[model samples]
Target: MTGATQRVADALRDAIEAGTYPPGGALPSSEDLAKAHGVAKVTAQKAVNQLAAEGYLTVVRRQPARVAEGPRRLSVVRDRKVYRDQIGYYFDQNAKPWGAIGTPTRGVATPPAHIADLLGTPRGRDVMTRTRLMAPKGSKVAHQVAISYIPVPVVAEVPAVGSSNTGPGGIYDRFEEHYGGPLEWRETVSARQSTSEEQTQLQIPANSSVLVVTREARIASGRTAVVVEVNETTMSAARFAVSYPIERDSSAGWSSTGGPRD
Candidate 1:
């Protein structure tokens, strides 16, 4: 949090993000950093220490700090098939970093303005909302956050979704069983500096950035089903990769349609 240290940390972080220091490569020591940045040793050390605390570096006694390996890559297939899988499978598999989603806080409440727009509901309209904080499984720092919003009508049809535990296959499965509707999904990815709250929740340092994935799930009938927001600190971006198997065209240059035979 120190100003001088943060400046130095920012420079080194840029270098790391730019791939100047490959994973597992050693970073300059505090003495070297101090000389390079014209700052005191303690200031340089804090810079390295802060990066380590933020999941960017590892500090071991008697050795220079080393760039840490990225967290497990979270790959989500962009298919519309019943997405009944719980998020635990994505972040908690092997339980290395995120072992389980902590107890969720859920209720009927008013969603944010943008989310309301996405849900096709009036602002301040009450809807079923669920918030979760993932639990760290090992020494890994907690770095992701998820929040979901669904219209009351849908929750009324599938009451289980209003509960903290949506049970096996999750809410989508419940929707399929109770509402008998096929769902479609779309996601938008963006990046920006982390907010103060995100910094605390994700344990990232000041000036750190995060990946914001705004997702919309709709029924085949063209009704907006639900909207979910997924957040991951930029420091963890190295560990995650997003792959969309887009189709190519002979004359059109690209195909806009998603489904088979479209």
Candidate 2:
């Protein structure tokens, strides 16, 4: 909000747009930026923080700030059945079918003990995890962050896990195809809040409520195939619309005037 902060933001924005600071590249330190822009160190720090809040940058402990990755392009579709079930808002990306578009990366820590219990797997067992940022088309800010987990055995079914495009049919579809059955059901829990790490990764404002959605999907054979956790914070105001069908009474016949018969 201050002049120094505005200058620092402008510099960072220009760096990103011009590729001076490429994606995944580290940003200069606050002290370095202040000297470079001839502004006070406090001003530079504020500017960096502002950019981080805007989702244009990310700051990791003891590491230089960096340009945050852009959101993945996703295709949105409408489904009547899903709409009726209050799951009408459908979004997907074709770049990766069963997994990520490149080599998968493992998280540093083992699966939390609670998650292991839920999945009936042992703690510290190797698992596959993938993360993605979601945003409205043409927007630089992310609206959601999704993380998915699968046991190593389930992930082995799809070797192309990290590079295949999961378009019309996503990973769930592929699971049915390979295993010859669909998921019997899935349970999801939602909440509102953001951790400091989430704030940095998502570029959300402090204290802003984020929609946290967690899901567990199971197949008929009792195998848990997918565990998804998503955190979404809207960059702007948006609305979700849904519609569905209701049962019709068959015993009632049409009247001569085309009205329902009594």
Candidate 3:
């Protein structure tokens, strides 16, 4: 992915990042780029294709490739505060704050082995599931995908959560209200190549990667009540900034400092 093709693509990417071609704005045609850069037309097309695969551009039929919209930057900070009438933090920050959520698909499904383990349930157990595909208010493309799972027992206690119309503040609010006590949450983040299913749901190029976040919610009774997995096409690596508070203790050497405690 280097040499002439990459050089040209890098130049165009830089221009796009600098806002020379904003989202929904078209870049120069391959013919124009070939003539301007003294390269073959095929080389120019390859460069454009590379940009598209990298999530920087998209093709328009009967027209030149257009600059793709950048991903919304989300800050992941260390905090355990729960607000009344608030949707889960990630949903609130990335989706609900900007627009209404598309109707979520609600039902019960068998949990995957890994999810079952996290929820402390036997494999193949049926669990309450809520899946959502969300786009910002005026955007045409969905930018976020989330699937939340609640053990069958937890669902029995808070039946309202099983419905798509879990009302304002969402399921977390219902948990606090019906389950008796404030809720606590912790999140673990990881990334990998997007699977075919993820590609289809996110409408991203096959070459693009995705960020996977695992969120766990615990009730006052100290039971892990919910586990949610969120997937999104990776934005430009340079775009996201993350911060976590560190507790300092002289008694423990720097090497001995444990991970953040929720």
Candidate 4:
């Protein structure tokens, strides 16, 4: 934010915090805000945009920017995901169950740059990808979208794995069979503004934030580990709480010196 925009934003934020403009309350129009703040209309708009991006305000065309209804409830707990020998890794579990919203899209395509890097493949290389939109069972509301990418070389070794229906156990089982090894999974989480396309697909607001989890599936090969697949999943930050339990390592114990023992 620019200096002028920051000033306007700070003032507006103070007013909101002071209950001058409570939650769900409307704020002045950009034109009025510009005049009041002695800043340009664009700067006032930028101020509103900044607050909207922070989830403090709701912005709609031809409407006065309003304070957000409330803080994120984050009611949905997203931690445990289920897996079975017959289906491999499947629908993620929470208090309420969710499933694929519709038929998944799958085909050969180039993986995203970071995904390709994780798969140890160069960008633009052909790979298989499956995209799925997921929502709670018996509901049409958007919950998450996942894209799973697999390298062509891995698929070539087990052609059936790339098929639309990978039979029982899905691709993970197939990959394990091909590698004669078990897969180890690791995930990294991040936060980012939802893209316009994601806003449409996920049915979220323009400035909504998303919790992004990128997971890599790797397997041991000889004395080295090889990344065979990577899956990227995104969910609305307002609706879901990402919770995970941390296990203490041996180094966590207190030492005679007072710090954790190594």
**Highest TM-score against the true fold, candidate:** 4
State which candidate, 1 or 4, has the greater lDDT. 4
Candidate 4 lDDT over 85-180, as tens digits, reads 344565344533567887988888887788889999998898998888877665455578888888888778778767888877777888888889
The ten-residue window of minimal lDDT in model 1 covers 227-236
Top-down TM-score ranking:
4, 3, 1, 2
Candidates in order, TM-scores: namely 0.56, 0.46, 0.58, 0.65
CA lDDT of every candidate: 0.64, 0.54, 0.65, 0.79
Better of 1 and 4 by TM-score: 4
> RMSD (Cα, Å) of candidate 2?
12.5
Question: Mind giving the per-residue lDDT tens digits that candidate 1 earns over 1-262?
Answer: 7888878988887577545676889988789999999999999999999888878898999999999877234553443332223342232232334543456677677776877888878898888777666545432344466777888876776788777777876766666566567555666666667778766666655666676666676664346444422222222354455455566655445345764453
Worst 10 residues of 3 by lDDT: 229-238
Question: Which segments of candidate 3 are over 4 A away from where they belong?
Answer: 1-96, 222-262
Model 1: clashing residue pairs?
none
Query: Model 3, residue 92: displacement in angstroms?
Result: 6.0
Candidate 2 vs candidate 3: which has greater TM-score? 3
Q: What local lDDT does model 4 show for residue 161? A: 68
Q: lDDT tens digits, residues 1-262, model 2?
A: 9766886787676456444675678888989999999999889988988878877788888889888876122322222222111222233332122222224234423555655665666887756666666544433534455666666666666644433455445566656666677544433434445666656655554554454444455655445454322212222111111222454668766778989977
Evaluated at residue 107, the lDDT of candidate 2 is 46
